[model samples]
Target: MTDVLARRVQASPDATALVGVGGAEWTYRELDEHVERVAGRLAALGIAGEHLGCLLETRPATAVLVHAAARLGCVLVPLNTRLTPTELDSHVERAELAALVCGADTADTAVELSVDVPTASVDDTEHTEITVLDSVSPAEFAPASRDADDPAVMLATSGTTGEPKLVVLTTENLRSSAVASAFRLGITPDDRWLDPLAVYHMGGLAPIVRSALYGTTVVIPGEFDARATLNALERFDCTGISLVPTMLRRLLAAGSLADSLRFVLLGGAPASEELIERCEKRGVPVHPTYGMTETASQVATARPGEAFAHTGTVGRPLLDTDLSVLGGDGKSVDIGETGELVVSGPTVFAGYYGDPDATARAFSERGFHTGDVGHRDAGGRLWVTGRRDEMISTGGELVAPGEIARVLRSHPAIDDAGVVGLPDPDWGERVGALVVGDVTDAETVRNYCRERLAGFKLPRTIAFADELPRTASGTVARRVVRERLLDNGD
Candidate 1:
C-alpha cells in the first residue's frame, strides 16, 4: 500500500485531519507537512527501520508521529506513561528499542528508560522547539516505500506468566482493521471522532490511523474527564467516539451524551449488562466490541441496533475475519458452549516480537488462541465469560495477578502472596490480594506495591492468611484464592 498519510493528503488535502478539542486543527496537507518534519528529525538520529519507543500522552503530536514513524519505516512502540521507571526499564530492554521519543511531560522518564538507547524531546504544542530534531531540516528526508507486511507497531501485552510480551502488528493488519471497522461502523467525510483514550492503547491509536485512511477527523480531548469529554462531544460536533466501560459509566453519571453523536465504540474491558441497558434506554448508541491488542483493534463489534436487541453479545466477527470457540479437545464446540475463543483474520498481528516459542504457542491449526473463554450463539455472536487465564480486567487495563504477587513477595515481611480479580460493579473486576505475611494492615502492603507497580496494578483490597492455597503441583490455586478473597469481603 502507498503511504497512508500521503495517500490521504492526495485525496483530501484541505480536509480537517487532526483537531485538538479546544486548541488547534490540522488539515490533511498540514498533517502531512508535520509528518515529514518529524520523519526528517528521526532520520537525523539514524532511526530508519528500527524500533522507536514513544513515551507520550494523547495529543496531536503523538498522532503526527504515528504517521511519521510509518513514513520512516520505524516500528512504533507506544510506551505506557503510567508505568514506573523500574517497570518501564524492563519493557524498554525487552523490546530492544533502538531509540526513544518523548513529549515534554515524559522527558525525565525517557531519560531513565533510555540509558542504553538514544532519546529525544519534542515540544507538543504549536511552537515547534524540538531537541534532537532541531539540528535537521525537512528537506533532508525522503519518505521510504514500505511493504504491506512490514511491522508497523509493537504493543506490549501481559503474558499468562505475567511477563510483558510485545505484539507486532504489520501495515496490512492495521489497514485491514480500519477497513473492517468502517464496514461495521460506517464512515463519513464529516465524521469527527473524539478520542480520550491514551495513544499507548490500540483503542486510542486506531482512531488516529483510521481517520487518516477514511479522510475524516480525529479530535483529541487531551484526557478522559467525564465532564470534559461530554463538553468536547458537543464542542467538536463529533459523530463517533471510543470508550472503555469506566469512562462511559462516568459520562452517564456526569451528563447526557451530545446530540451530534452517532456511535460509541466500547471495548478495552467488559461493559456491564446494566451499563449497556442504561445506554439503550437513554438513546445512546453503544456498540460493545471484543478485541485485544493482537487484533489491531476490533474482532467482533455489535452495532447499535444489534446491541439494543442482544444486550450482552459482542456481535459477529468483522468482515474478512473468522472466529471459533474451541473445547479442550481442540475442536470447535457446539453453539452456546463455552470454550476458548480463537480468532483468524487479516487483522491478526504478525507475532510476539523476538519470541518464537510464544509465537508458536499463541497459534494453533485453527487460529490464534485468544485465552478468553466465551461462547457463540447460533447467530454467530460472541458472549464472553471470563479469562481462561488469571489476568485481571480492572477498568480498561489488564493486570497480571502474578505480577502483583511478585511485587508482594518482594516485601520484607511478606512470605507469599496470591492475587486475583474479584467481581465489581464499577471496574468490571477489582484486584484483590491474599497475603501470608507479617502485615498488620492492608495499607502497608499497598504502599509497598505502589512504589513498584502502576496504580491500576496495585491491589485494591488485601486479606491476610497463614498461607496461600496451592495445587498439588505446588502452584498457587488462583480459583481458591479468588473464592477465599471474596469470602473475606472488603
Candidate 2:
C-alpha cells in the first residue's frame, strides 16, 4: 500500500490535516510538504533506515517526525518525555538507536543523554553537538516502499512491573489497527479526532495514523488542560476523542461536553462505574476500551451507547481480532470464568525488539498473552478483572485488586482508588488501598468496602490521599502506590 500520508494528500489535499492547540492549522497538502522536508533533513543526516528516537511533546513537529520516519523507512522510536535522563539512556541503548530527535521541551535531556547518536533539535535553540533540524533542506524525494512486515514503530512498555520491553509494530499492524478502529467507531470523511495524549505512547501515536488513513483531521493540544480540551472539542468540531479516565473526570467536572463530540475513547486504564455513570448523566458519549501497546491501540472497544448500558464491559474483540480467556493450563476457560485474556490478530505486534526468547514466551498457541485478567460473558462482551501478576495472594486466597478498587471508586465520596498487596507477617501479603477523595475518614471508606467486598478482599488498611500516583498514560501506578505504602509502614 502507498504511504498513508501520500494517499491522504492525493485523496484530499485541501482537507484539514492537523490543528495545534495554539490555533495553528495544517492542510493535508501542507502537512505532507512538512513531512517531506523533515524526511529530507533526516536523509541529510544519513539516518535513513535507522532507528530514530524522538523525544518530543504532542505538537505538529512531533507528528511530522512520526510520518517522516515512515516515509524514509526508518523505525520511529518515540521516547517518553517524562523519562529521566538515565531512563532515556537505557532505552536508547536497548533500542540500538542511530539518532535522536528532540523538541524544545526535551532538548536539554537529549543533550544530556549518554548516547553517542547524532542528535537533532527541532527548536531554534542550539545544543553543543546537536544539528538544527530546520536548517537542512533537500530536494523532495519519493516515499520509501516499505513492506507490510517492515517494522514501522517501536514502543516501550509502561514498565510498571519490570524493565520496559520494546514492542515493534510493522506497517501492516498499524494499518490493520487503524482500519479496525474506524470500522468499530464509525468513522466519517469529515471526522476530526481530538488527541491530548502523550505522543510517545500508542494511545497518542495511533490517532495520528488513524487520521492519516481516514483522511480526517486530528486536533492536538500543547498539553492536557481540561478547559482547553473542551474548547478545542467545540472549536475544531471534533467528532471523536481519545482520553484516559482521569482526563474524562476532569472534563466532566469542568463543564459539559459539546454535542459535536460523538465518541470518547476511554482507555489507558479501566473506567469505574461511577465515572461512567457521570458521563452518561452529563450526555457525554464514552466508549470504555480494552487494549495495550502490543495490540497497537485498541483490541476491543464498546460503542458509546452500549458502554452506557453495560457499564464496565469493554465490548467484544474487533473484527479480524480474536480474544480468549485462558486458564493456568493454557486452556480456554468457561464463559464468566476469569482467566488471562489472550489476543490474536493482524494488529498484534510482531514481538519484543531484539529479544526472541521473551517474544516466544509472550506468545502461546492461542496468541499473544496479554498478562491481563478478564472474563467473557454469555453475550460475548469482555470484562477486565485485573492484571495476572497484580493478583494479591493474602492468607492463601487470591484476590483481584481491580475488583476492590472498582468497589472503592463506587463510593460517592471517592474520586479514585488504587489497591495493592502489602507485606505482612501473618498473611503472605495483606490487602491495602490508597484512595483519592473528599472523604477524610478512612473508617468510612473501609466500611463502604466492607459492604461490597469479601472479608479477605476488603482492604486491611485504607489511606486517604488528595490524589493517587499515576503513570503517564493515567493508569494508577500500582508500584508507586506499593512503594508509598512500604515507605509509610502501612
Best by lDDT: 2
Name the runs in model 1 displaced over 4 angstroms.
Answer: 124-132, 159-161, 390-490
Model 1 lowest lDDT segment of ten? 123-132
Q: How accurate is candidate 2 locally (lDDT)?
A: 0.88
TM-score of 1: 0.80
Question: Model 2: residues >4 Å from true position, as ranges?
Answer: 139-142, 487-490
Tens digits of per-residue lDDT, candidate 2, 405-433, equal: 89988988888888999888999999888
How high a TM-score does candidate 2 get? Answer: 0.97
lDDT of 1 by residue, 1-490 (tens): 4378999899999999999857589999999988888888788778888899998899988998888888888889998897778788988988888888887788767666534777777654232333555555554766777789888999887433567689999999999999999999988889999989887789989999899999999999896799998988988889999998768978998999999998899997666566777898999989999998899989999998888888778899999999989988999899988778999989999999999999999999799998888888888788886567777879998776645765676676876677888988999999999998687588888888899999998898789899877542134667788888888845
Clashing pairs in 1: none
